[model samples]
Target: MNEYKIEDLLFEELILMDQEASDYEDLITQIGELAFEKGYVDKEFSKAVIEREKLYPTGLPTNKVKVAIPHAMVRDNVKKSAIIISKLKKPVLFKEMGSSTDSFIPVDIVFLLAVNGSKDQLTILQKLVGMFSDDDAMVKLNDMKTASDTIGVLKEILSQ
Candidate 1:
């Protein structure tokens, strides 16, 4: 579990404060390109994520804020263990996680996870779920005005 620090996996460069996307696929593509260009993920990362979302949606409908945690298997695709946090300009529809079908939600935030392996992914997902369940934390994230502010809030919540 000590393979990587939660705070260390966050990069200021990957904090997308105001992202605009027509749909979830577009959002993932934009974020994926950023990560790929930064050498964090491979070229096929975005496509893989989209496919995975179709089968196992990551859309999480939290109490205060709707969010999504999208990711693909590492499988040598991730060059670095970094999370790309994107605050969309507007909410986008996503199939809710654990839904059989016909269940969707408008997501305000996107957490594009580019981690090392299954172990790290599960650990980060647990931490993220805890953060999402916190009303105060989700509200704070929603109100963040800058990328650095987002990082600060995430570091504080994720560290706990």
Candidate 2:
């Protein structure tokens, strides 16, 4: 398996707003626009993001370290890629994948995955899951309050 480095995949282009929005719709819209502005997405990318979220929820369950992975097809957008990390002040409700019930996940970390396709996206996802699966790494990420701090922690994890 290819070891995906979150830092290499992330940069200032991936850092977005840190405040919480009223709802998922607004949150997704704001993040999608930022992705587009950074050349990671296209004009219609917002619609795709919403549609993808409706089909496959990206929220992951955790007690201390909550996160969400929102992603869509690159064909619907551009060839360039990015992974945005946002720290929200409040929790958001997202549907669980393969299930009808929704989960009120207190997601302080949001990883907006922008990839080319299933293969590359899956690779990135695997690395992300593997890296964050460690309780220590998750704690470090949760404690991070700034984009630079978060990126630094991710880089350290990638180096290991």
Give the top-scoring candidate (TM-score).
Answer: 1
lDDT of 1 by residue, 1-160 (tens): 6877878899999999878999999999999999999999999999989988888999998998999999985447888889999998899899999988769989999998988788888998898898899999999989998999999988888888
Alpha-carbon runs more than 4 Å astray in model 2: 1-5
* Highest lDDT against the true fold, candidate: 1
TM-score of 1: 0.97
Model 2 misses residue 128 by how many Å?
1.0
Off by over 4 Å in 1: none
Error of 2 at 118 (Å): 2.2
TM-score of each model, paired residue for residue: 0.97, 0.87
lDDT (tens digit, per residue) of candidate 2 on 1-160? 2545446678865675466887666777888887777777787777787788888887777556777887764455854767877777776666655566765565667787777667778877887877767878889877787778878888888667
Which pairs in model 2 have colliding backbones? Answer: none
